[model samples]
Target: MRPADLAGVDVLILDRPPGGIAAFDLLETARAGGARLLCDVSDRDHDFEARIAALGLEAARDQANALHLAAVERRAVLALADAILLADPAPDAVLRALGKPLLPVTTPADLKAVLQGGERI
Candidate 1:
């Protein structure tokens, strides 16, 4: 949605990687329009690159590479995000570096509950 279209939106939550390039722009736009932006960084595992390489499988290696790239993209989304939800425990150093708000999320219900809390949004 365009920035104008986000007017009065209560919350805008997006899954990175699935939303791809457009998600980054949308997060910024929605935030500008006074909507709360939340990013779910659940696609990439914490030790994806390292663990996949240790498995010694060609296909797994490729998947690891792809996950690494996706992690890079997630960083951009995190920059625009108002709050962050993690599928993995303690995000990597990059996320720690950004230092934006971080929230725990184990399931869809967990995320929904946080959104409903009405504090961070």
Candidate 2:
């Protein structure tokens, strides 16, 4: 989707940015506003697993610790994200199928430009 289309979204995601594109980097602004950032576990060589391990997360761990468990990068990002971005071929569809808030960002400019519009990315 294009910049104008994402008028009310509060979160942004992408696999990577366009070549030489320095303007868009959705995470920068989203994190600034405390928006969650979700990405597929496979996107970056299973970094999700490492994050979970580092955070001592256990899946289906418990409701009381849901917040704590989710604080693990993978789950936390999803839990806090107002919107999730998908750039991988099937990952986007998979995330959407799981009912995660998902959007598409094709370029860094798309993200950077959005912020330039005076709205959070």
Candidate 3:
């Protein structure tokens, strides 16, 4: 989607990073529009390779490789995130590199608090 489409957006929660160069432009627009960017990094833990293999797909290897590449592209979005939503307090190197606040939320109340500008639980 174009940056202009993000007008009036208060927050942009990305489960996965947007593909290609447009990701940065959209993010910049959102930020400029006073929107908070929150990356839900817990989704990164899903093992696409294992899942594809379990499904017995012959092209599992190729599919897994493609998925990995897509995940790698997420760095752009992560770098611009105002905060990260994780399943646990454990911080990975990538997340730490972003230097953004990590909010480990396990319950709906915790998520609500975080979204409302509350401290990490």
Candidate 4:
């Protein structure tokens, strides 16, 4: 569905910006009707750097590019989101430092804990 169609949606599970799309591009339209963002931030800049170092820069070149884009997009999404789903603890620090308001939904256990705690997000 188009971003506009997602307005007022209960959840928008974005894995990596849609084909040929950037996360920032859909922000305004996607949230226009007030939808909760379940953004997936699988990696951060630091994590990418670590991957590159481990596998060698040349081997991880593609990941570097993806990370650069993710850093820009994820930060923007987090700023406007009701909650965030990520895999890295480093992102916690990034979020805290930016003072962005978002609930971190990392693993299934974490999501379960949130539901159990009555923190619907």
**Candidate with maximal TM-score:** 3
Number of colliding residue pairs in each model: 0, 3, 0, 0
The CA lDDT of each predicted structure is 0.68, 0.43, 0.75, 0.58
On the 0 to 100 scale, the lDDT of residue 36 in model 2 is 44
TM-score, cand. 4: 0.56
The best candidate by lDDT is 3
Which consecutive 10 residues in model 3 have the weakest lDDT in total? 44-53
Per residue, candidate 3 scores C-alpha lDDT tens digits across 10-68 of 98888765756788888889999999988887655334444465646766665777766
- Please write out the lDDT profile of model 2 over residues 23-85, one tens digit for every residue: 233344455655445453335322334434554535424332443333343443444445445
Q: Sort every candidate by TM-score, greatest first.
A: 3, 1, 4, 2
Question: Model 2 off-target regions past 4 Å?
Answer: 1-73, 92-94, 113-121
Q: What C-alpha lDDT, on a 0 to 100 scale, does residue 47 get in candidate 2?
A: 37
Q: Compute the lDDT for candidate 4.
A: 0.58
Report the alpha-carbon TM-score of model 3 versus the true structure: 0.72
RMSD of each predicted structure: 3.7, 11.9, 3.8, 4.2
Q: Provide TM-scores for the models.
A: 0.64, 0.33, 0.72, 0.56
Weakest lDDT window of 10 consecutive positions for candidate 1: 42-51
Over 7-105, each residue of candidate 4 has an lDDT whose tens digit, in order, gives: 566556566433224455566566676655565656544234454677676777856787655556556666666556656645646656655434567
Candidate 1, 44-92: lDDT as tens digits: 4434465466656877756776766665665666777777887776776
